[model samples]
Target: MKKYVRGLAIVGVLTLAVAACGSKPAENTAGGDANKDFKACMVSDSGGFDDKSFNQTSYEGFQAAVKAKGLTPVKAESKSDNDYPTNMTAMVAAKCNVIVAVGFKLEDATDKAAKANPSIKFAIVDSAPATPIENVKPLSFNTAQASFQAGYLAAGMSKSGKVGTFGGLKIPPVTIFMDGFAEGVRYYNKQKSKNVQVLGWDDAKQAGLFAGGFEDKAKGQNTAQNLITQGADIIFPVAGPSGLGGLQAAKASNGKVNAIWVDTDGCVSAAEYCSVLISSVKKGMDVAVQDAITSVVDNKFDNKQFIGTLENGGTSLAPFHEFDSKVPAELKTELDTIKADLIAGKITLESKAQPKAS
Candidate 1:
């Protein structure tokens, strides 16, 4: 929660146990002979590592932990839903001491893998299993809190008085963002007596637009263009790689449209679209992934759920970047107040998709 630091190296000296086959020990410097056999692996969702989103952020953490501990690093990238089980099985066959499965779609496969292979530690990003598995830990986030701020920000900045958002799927993880974003706009309307509209999601109805999945940029672009046609000046896309299409749409609008990114800072991860980005809703998936790996290496692994919140450093809004000069000073001050109020519980979000507070 405090963010990953060199202090994690303290756990590097311990050895992780993995009795599975298909793995040969590799030499390492940090953890000595015991750690030489320790192998940390990851399984990506269909979005892959270059999605400039959660999958990429999660892998960064996994690699950081492996690098710090001098453990063997391995990964399996899924090409589609059907690949989940097969990729996870490959990690098991590779004798991975710990395997981190990225994205909520991997929940079933991760749950099955952990139960079938009780000895291997597992962590799943963005989701937790229906029933607790002793070998699996859940890495989740209360992204709604940060997205609430993004919603408010979009509302305050919209020139057309309309904002829009769409998700990659209809799952809790994705809807959670739309819920918060919609509510944020509603909050702004209440405070300013302005009729700022949210086009793609209706939090009360628990329904809105979705790209069906996270991999198709064409669908995302089409969805964003639709919102733009409806006069939405600011768009939010919660669909990993597909979300890039929203940026593409915004860019094509010239100076008329702008957007907000999710998962990672768009300015840093998708610089080509920075001109149209207002900001990003960020999750500390990298830190969570690294912490999970560190726990495994220290032999202190548990199935406890790791819930990231605004109170923790687990979720936040990225800096305004190029929009810094354009956002009004009063609006920035108002955002600060809103953030403080949210943290103090003076403001409450209405999203049913938010993860249970830890």
Candidate 2:
């Protein structure tokens, strides 16, 4: 009787171990089965999380979606452009139902990966694949409208009557921001009858300082300083990561200078210079990502591209933080009017190849 009892106990232990092993595969497979639960994944560009620009904004969006849907979300950060493909592949292999790639820099890699993994769904920010895949969705922003607001504010607030803009690359998105900014300045000038000169990238020449790369803060600082020395009291740094250098330069200039930040709210993100930042171009990535994930959760994930524009309430200008009191009441009123006009199609912020001279 004792021998029989011991043998039964051993068998029970084995049964429990086997049950535990069976549960492991369920957890692994649970994420991929859309019928059960959807898993979302993201692969970031070389800028990483703290770049204080596109990467951070995109990540925030992805996180919001994950939280809202109660879905498992994974992120693979690329140290360089070369790592994009490999990191993307790893997420695909993990059976992520949806993968979001941040930044235009990941366009090529994301395109290749999406094609290779036909079963996987993809969403990319700031870019669209050349050939649209049925499974991939593109998300782009109307940065022009937001930047135009920044320009209008800068033009109205510039003490020196000169504002400048610098970009890391002359890409369409960056150029669109610059174009809208220039137009805003022109609009402000036309409305107020003031001459505010804009320097740095010329829409006509289609030329500007690249800073060679986006990660070089020193270059950004120097570029901004040069623009400041040329009598630009307000400067817009549209270059990701490098924009921080511009902010630093503005701070070192002893509060006489101010800057406009891009992608995220610089006031909250860069609190040290919040006092100097006039405003920021707001991109609603958080909302976009949340919407994308919700669609997946509700089994309504459609192969539709998302365009975040002013009309859609996907982008706007951040409120004046420390400059709230400094900005005149009249200027604020005028800015509101302009925003309304732009939204209502009363005013069009058209992209032009020629830079209007101050």
Off by over 4 Å in 1: 1-34
The CA lDDT of each predicted structure is 0.82, 0.72
Pairs in steric clash, model 2: none
Q: What is the TM-score of each candidate against the true structure?
A: 0.90, 0.86
Candidate 2 residue 215 C-alpha distance from true site, Å: 1.2
Candidate 1's TM-score reads 0.90
Q: RMSD to native for every prediction?
A: 5.8, 13.1
lDDT of 2 by residue, 1-358 (tens): 0000000000000011111122211232222233335667777766676677777777777766666556666666666667666666666666778888776777777778888888887777767655557777777777788888889999989989999999877666567778888889988899889889898866656676555557789999999999999999998988877878999999999978999998889987778779789999988866776677667667687666677877787788898988899999998888788888888989886674211211
Best by lDDT: 1
Clash pairs of candidate 1?
A: none
Q: For residues 1-358, what per-residue lDDT tens digits would candidate 1 score against the true structure?
A: 2111000001112222221233333323442334567878877777877788878888778877877777767666666777677777767776879988887777777778889999999988877776678998888888899999999999999999999999888888888889999989999999999999999999999888988888899999999999999999999999988999999999999889999999889999999999999999998989999999999889889888889988888999999999999999998898888889989999998787777623
